[model samples]
Target: MSEMCPCGALLGESLMPREMAEEGIFSNLLEILMSASSEIEQACKDSNESVDLDTCLLLTAECFRCLRNACVECAKNQHVMRNLGLISTSVHLIKLLHGIQMKEELLLTALRCSLQFLGNIAAGNRDSQNSIWKCAFPDLFLTCLTYNDEKIVAYCCMILFTCLNSEKVRELLDPGNLTVAFHVLKVYKEQLESEWSFLIVTDHLLKCPELVKALYAKLSNQERVTLLELIMVNVNEKNPVTSEEVNVLMTHADFLAGCFQENCEAVLKLTSAADAEDEEALVTIRLLDVLCEMTSNNGQIEHLQSLPGLLETAIDTLRLTHIAGKQAVNIFTATHAMTGQEEISHPAVGFKSHLIRLIGNLCYKNKKNQDKVYELDGIPLILDNCSIDDNNPFVNQWAVYAIRNLTEHNERNQELIAQMEEKGLADNSALESMGLEIEKRDDKLILRSVRKKPS
Candidate 1:
C-alpha cells in the first residue's frame, strides 16, 4: 500500500501552538469533527427551521464544543481545514445561519460558534477576510446587533471589525450603513473590545457629517475625548479634514480651544486628585495632544494664547512626568517595540516629542511667550532633552528644533545656547543634523540652524 500522507495532521497542527499539539488536542479535535461529519450532513438534509431540528442541533453543538477551544481558531484556515473537507461545510453553515437562530439554547450552542469561526478565520487570513466580507453584509450584521443576545452581538462586532486595518477590507466598510457598529458602541461601549471595534468603525465614518455630529452629542465626555483622539489620529491622510464631517473640529476655534482648556484643567486636577499615571491623566494628556495639533491656525493660536497659565501648566505636567522618567522609561522599553524591530516611532517617544513641539510652537516668534517659557524655567527641561537620552530616541531631534525656535531673535536665549555650546552641553548630533552654524558678529555670538544665503 502507498504510504499515508502526513500533510493532513501536520497542516492542522501547524495552526495550533506546539504545546497544544504535544497534548494531542489537535488530533483529538480532528477525530471528533470527522466522526460527526456524516451525521451532521445527514441531519442538515433532513431538518428544516422547525421539523427534526434536534439531531442537526446536537451534531452542531458537539462541533461547536470542539471549535470553542483555542486551537480551533488556528485551524480555521482553508489550507488547514481543507485537509478533511471541513472548510466548505463550515462556510456553508455560517452562511445558512447568518441571522437565524432556533432558540436561546440553540443560539448559544451553534450560531455563536459559527460567527466566531468566521471572525477568527478572517483575523489574519486575507482570503477568508475577503470571503467573509462578501458573505456577511451590513443587513445580516444589523440583524445580529438588534438581537438581545450580548454574546451574539459581540461576535458580530468581532467578525466585522477584524480586518478593518486592511485596505481591501476597508472597502467593505460602507460608511452610511455604520449604524450597526454604532449600535454596538451605544449598547456596549463599556466593554473594552467593543470600544476597539467602535473606534475602527467610526474611523471610517469621519467623512460622514451627520453621523459624526450625532455621535459627538450621543457619547459621554470621556468617550467623546477618546473617540475624537482616535478619529484625529487615524483618519486617512489622503482624505483627512476634507469634508465638513471632520472639518468642524478642525475649523471651530472656540470649541477646540474650550476642549484644550478643559482638558488642561482636568490634568491639573488629576495632579492633586489622582495618581500621575491614572486613566484620567492619560485621557487629559491625549486631549491636550489633540489641542496641541489644532493650534496650527492663526485663529486657534490667538484663542490658545489667551488661555493664561495653560501653556505653563502643560510644561509643568511634562516636568512631573520627567520625575518618573526612569520608571516610565523602563516600562516603555519592556512593552514597546524596540529599535531594530522596525522603523516605527515608539509611542512614548512620540508623546514626549509632541509636547516639546507644542512648546516650540508656543515660543515660535512669540517673544512674550518665549519670555514666559524662560520665566517658567523651561530652559533646563529643554536642555535636558538636548543630549541623546537612552529612553527617548527622538528627543534630541525635537529638542534641537525647540531650542532653535526658542532662541530665535532673542539675545538672552541665544546667550544660554552659546554657554551650552561652550560647555559641551548642547547636543552636537542635533546641531549637526540641523546644519547648525555659528557666526561672530561684532562682539556677540549668533547661532542659527540654517544659514541665510546672500539674501
Candidate 2:
C-alpha cells in the first residue's frame, strides 16, 4: 500500500492539471473529512484528554486546507465536492467547532479553513455559489462576521463577496433582511481593519444604484451615517470619480440632502457647544463633508439644492457651528495668550469650512442660490470665517471660493461683499496675515501683495 497522507492527497492532485474527480480524489478527501468529523465528535463527547481533541482539530483543518487547495480553479473538483455534500459538512463542522470550547486557535483555524473551502469552491460557479448561499445566507454569515477574529470575519466576507449575485444582493436588501446586510457593512466599517474583502462586497452592492437607493431608504439616521462613511471611503480613493460613482451620487443626491437636513436639525436643537461635542456631532460633521463632496459634482448640485430645507440646513449648521467655534477660539485665546500654548480648536470647528464649501458649490454659476445666500445674510458669516483656524484647515480658501461664487454674475451679492469690505465690517487682519492688502482703486477693491525690504 502506498504510504500517503489522506489530507495531502487532494493537494497533490491540485498541483497537476488532471481533474481530482477523474481519479476519485474528491471522494477520498470527503471520506477523510468524514472520518475526522466522527473523531472530533467522539473526542468532544467521550475523551477528557485535550490532546485527542487537538489532534482531531488539526487533522480536520489539514483536510479543509487540502480541499480548499483542490477546489482552486477546478470546476470538476468543486462540482464533485458540492455533489458529495462538502458544503453542508463544512458548515456542520464550523457549527460543531463553534459549539465546542476546545483550544481556541485550533477551533478558529478550522472555521477559517472551512470558509476558505466554501469561498473557493463557490468562486465562479453559480450553482455551487447558490448552494452555499442557501445554506448560510444571512444568519450564519452575520454570526461569523460578529466574531472577534478578523481573519474569520474576512473569510466570511469573502464568501459573501463570492456568492452574492445581483438577485441575492437585492434579496438581502429587502426591508426584513437588509438589517443583516447593514450589520455586515457596519462590521466592515468598525471591526475589520483590512479592506480588500469588505471593499469588494461593498463596492459590488453599491454599484446597483436602485438597490442602493432602496437600501438607503430603509436605514435609520445612525445607519445612514455609517453607509455614507462607507461610500465616502470609496469616493476619496479614486482620483477622478468613475462613472459608476457618479451614478451613485446622482441617485442619492436628494436623500443625502434630506439626511443633511435632519442632521442640521439635530445640531440646531443642541443648546450649547459642549452638547455638540459628542459622537453624534462628529457624525453630523462627517455628513457635512459628504455633502461637500456631493455638491462638488455639478450634476448633483441642482438636485441637492432643489430639495427643501437643504439651504436652511446649510445655513443653520453654519450659524450653529460658527457660534460654537468662535466661542471656543475666544476662550482659547484668552487663556493661552501669555502661555503661548497651541489652541485645540473645538470639535465643531471644521464644520464651518465644510459648510462654506457646500455653499460655494451650490452657488457656483447659480444666481438663485447666490441671491438666497445674500438674503440669509450668509455673506457676512462667510466673510467672518475667512480668518485662519488650526482645526479648520483651508477654511480661508473655501471662504474665498464661496465669496467668488456668491458674487459671480450676481450684482446684489457682489455689492453686499464690496460694501462689507468698504465699511471695514470685514476685518483686514485676515488680508494682512496673508501678506495681501486691499485698496480701493477706480471704485474697485484691488488685492495687492505687500512688498518686503531687501535683506
Candidate 3:
C-alpha cells in the first residue's frame, strides 16, 4: 500500500492523512501544532485579529491534551514521556497553550502540562516572563464584570495589574485592550451596587501613577470638568451611595488638585463672572467644593498655592451673604486643620487681609445689631465670630461676654484690649471715669484697672 501523505488533505483522487498509523498520526499532530503556533504568533505580530489564530490555538491545545494522555496511557512505551517533554520544550507549544482560549478547561489543562515541563527547562534560568499573559482577555474579563462575576473580574484585574508592572509588558498592551479594560471599570463604577468596582479601580490606579496621569491627559478638558462635577455632586448629595465615593475622591486628591490648579482661573472666570441667575454658578460651587475637599488632604497649602486666585475667590465667595459662608468656612477650617497651618502664613496678607476686611464688615453690622440683638436672629452668631476678629472692639466686648462662662482668665480681657489697640481703638473717657485702664504690652494691650487711664 502507498504511504499516506501528512498534509491531512487530498489532492485529486488521493487521500492524504498527513501521515499513517498511531505514531505517524502523533508526528503529524505535532507538526500541525507547531505550524498553528507559528501562525498564531504571526497573527499577533500583524494585527489584533486573533479569532482565527485562537481557533487554531484551540486545536493545538486539544492535540497537546490528547498526546499527553496518550503518553501516560502508553507508559509502557518508555519513550512516551521523553517525547512529551520534547514537545513541551517547543516555544511554539508554550505560545500555543498561552494563546488558547483561557476559558476552556482543556486549554487550561494543556497550559498546566506545558508549564510544568517548560518550568523545568527554564528553571533558575531567568527567561522573559510570558509576554502573551499580559494580553488582556478583554472580552472574557469584561464579560465577567458585566455578568457581575466579581471574583473572576477581580482575579483578572489582579493579573492585568501585575502584568502591567513590567515596563515591557505594559508597552506591549494594545491601547484598545486597555480601553476595554477601563470601560469595564467604568461599567462597574456605574452598575455595581457594592464598592468592589471602586476598590479594584483604585487599587489598580494606585499601582500605576503613569496610567492615572495618562488617563487625565487623555480626557478632554470638558470630560475632566465633567468628571470633577460628577465627583462633587456625589460627594455633596443629600446622601451618598457609599463612603467609598468620598474615599476614591480622596485617593486621587493630588491628581484632582493638579487639574483644579491648572483650570482654576478658567473655572473662576466662568463661574464668578457668570450671571448669578445661571445654573452654572451651582456647577462652580460644586467645583469649588471639590477643590476644597481635594485640598483638605495633606500638603493642601502647597496645592492651594498652585491656584493663583483660588484663595481670593474663596474669600470673596464666603463674604457673600448669598453664598453658604458657613459651609465655606467649614471647608477652609477643615483644610487648615488638616494641614495644621494657617490659611495664610502671613496674617498680614492674603486671607488675613480678607479676614480683616470681613471683620470690618462684621463690626459695622454688629453696630447696627447692638440695639436690636433680641430682634436680629444673627446677633449671637455675629458675637461669636467677632470674638475671634483681631480688628474689632465693640464686637469683641460682646463676644467676650458671650464666652465669659467659659473662661475667667485675664486672657479674654487682655485679648479684647489687644484687639482694640491693633485697630487703634481706645476706651472712651466716659467709660474710663467709671474706671477702666488699658495698658499696652509689647505683644498685646492689657486692661489693668477699672479706675485708671494711661497717662
Candidate 4:
C-alpha cells in the first residue's frame, strides 16, 4: 500500500514487537502531531460557524487536555497562535454563559477553565492586553449575575467584589453592573439563605461602602420601613437556621442605627403594640436589643424614653414562665440600663413584684448597669420582698443580688442589709455558698466577692 502512513503504521505494528513498544522505544519514535493538528483544525473550523457556545466550550475544554500533551511541540514550533480559533471560541462561550437556566456547576467549571487559558495566553503575548478579547469578555462576566442559581449568583458576587479592587476593572463596571448585582441580590435572596452565600453578599456590600450609602439614599422611607419589616419577619420565621437571616440583620445594623438616630420615635412606634400572645414578641425583643446595642451611646434618647413601659410589659409576659419571654425581659432590662432609664412601676402589687424581681436580677446579673442599678429607688422594696417567705428561687436569688449590689457601695444600703439580716431575710448559707464576702470599712460596705459564673 504505498508505504502505509508511517506514524499510524508504526503505532500499530509496534504493538507486535513487545520489546520495541513495551520498552518505550517505538512509542517515543512515533509522532501524533498531524493527528492533534487535524483535531485542532477541525475545532477551529467549527468555531467559524454559528455553533452553540456551550457545545464549543465543552469541546475546547476537552481539547485543552490534548493541547497540554502537545505543549512542548507547539511551543518549540511557535504554533500556539494556530489556536486563535480557540480564543475566539472562548469569547463566544462567554456569551452563552449568561442566561438564568444554564447548569451552574457545569457552566462555571467551563468558564473558569476557559478564562484561565485565555489569561495564560494574554500573559504570554505582549500585545494581548490591547486585544479585542479584553472588551469582549467582561460583559459576559457581568451577565453572570443574572443566573438563577444562587451558588452562581454568589460566585459572581464574589468575583465582582474582588474585581472592584482593581482600578481598571472598577472603571469597567458602570452603574449598570452594580444595578445588575443588586437585582440579582433581590431576585435570589430567598435562595441565598445559606451562610456562605449570605456572607459573600454581605462582605461585598460592606467592602463597597459607597454601595451601602447609595442603597440607603435610594431607598424611600416606605421602602426602608418595608425592608426592616421583612428583616424582622425573616428573623422571626421558624425556618431552619440560615446565615441569611443573621447576615441581613448584621448588614442592616448600621442603617437601622442611622434610622433610629434620625427618627427614634418613628422606629419605636413600630414596636409599640407587641402582644403577650404573639409568638413574634421574641423577635421584637431581639430587634429591640439590637436597637439598644446600636444606640448604646444614647444617640436616640427619645427612642429609649418609650422603652420602660415595654420593659414592664415584657416582665409581665415572663410570668407565663416562657424562657423566651424571660430572655426578652433580660434584654429589655439591659436596654433600660443602657439608655439610663428605669423600669416604670405598675400600680398592682403582682406587677410591682415582677418589676422588683426584674430590678433585683439586673442588680445582681448585670455589672455594666451597676451604676444604673443605683438609680432604681426600689431597692428597699426589693429587699422587703426578699425578706418575705417565698419558694421562688427567681425571687430569692435576685433579692440576694439586689441586696449585695445595693449594700456594696452605700452606708444606707448597709443599714438595709442589717435590717434584712435581723429579720433573718438574708440567707447566710446562700450568701456563703455564692461566695459573697461583705465587710464594713469606715463609711462604706465593701463587696469582697468575685463573680464565679458570668452573669
Per-residue lDDT of model 3, residues 354-404, tens digit only: 332322222232322222222332223322244333222233444334323
Pairs of residues at least 3 apart in sequence or in different chains that clash in candidate 3: 5-18, 6-18, 7-18, 435-450, 435-451, 436-450
Clash count per candidate: 0, 0, 6, 0
| lDDT scores in order | 0.56, 0.70, 0.40, 0.40
User: What's the distance in Å from true for residue 345, model 3?
Assistant: 36
lDDT per residue as tens, model 2, 86-129: 88877777877776765479888888888888878887899899
What does candidate 4's lDDT look like per residue over 257-315, in tens digits?
Answer: 44433442222222223432232333333334444333232323233323334333323
Q: Which stretches of candidate 2 lie over 4 Å from their true place?
A: 1-14, 17-23, 34-56, 208-226, 238-245, 268-277, 324-346, 428-455
Tens digits of per-residue lDDT, candidate 1, 1-455, equal: 32321111233433445224333443455555454454455555666523444555566656654543343345343335434434445555544554343555864657676666556556567666666655556656676776667777777777666645445333434565556546655544555556545645455455444455556555666666666565555432323334543454444333444455555444433323224355544555666666666555443465465556656866775675565453444312212344655554322334556667778777767888787878888877777655555445666677877777788888888776666666687665556655675566787767766753554
| Candidate 4: pairs in clash | none
Candidate 1 vs 3: which has more lDDT: 1
Question: What C-alpha RMSD separates each model from the true structure?
Answer: 13.3, 5.7, 18.0, 15.0
Model 1 stretches with alpha carbons more than 4 Å out: 1-226, 234-247, 250-278, 292-310, 326-349, 364-368, 419-434, 450-455
Model 1 worst lDDT window (10 residues): 1-10
Question: Best candidate, lDDT-wise?
Answer: 2
Model 4, position 370: C-alpha lDDT score: 41
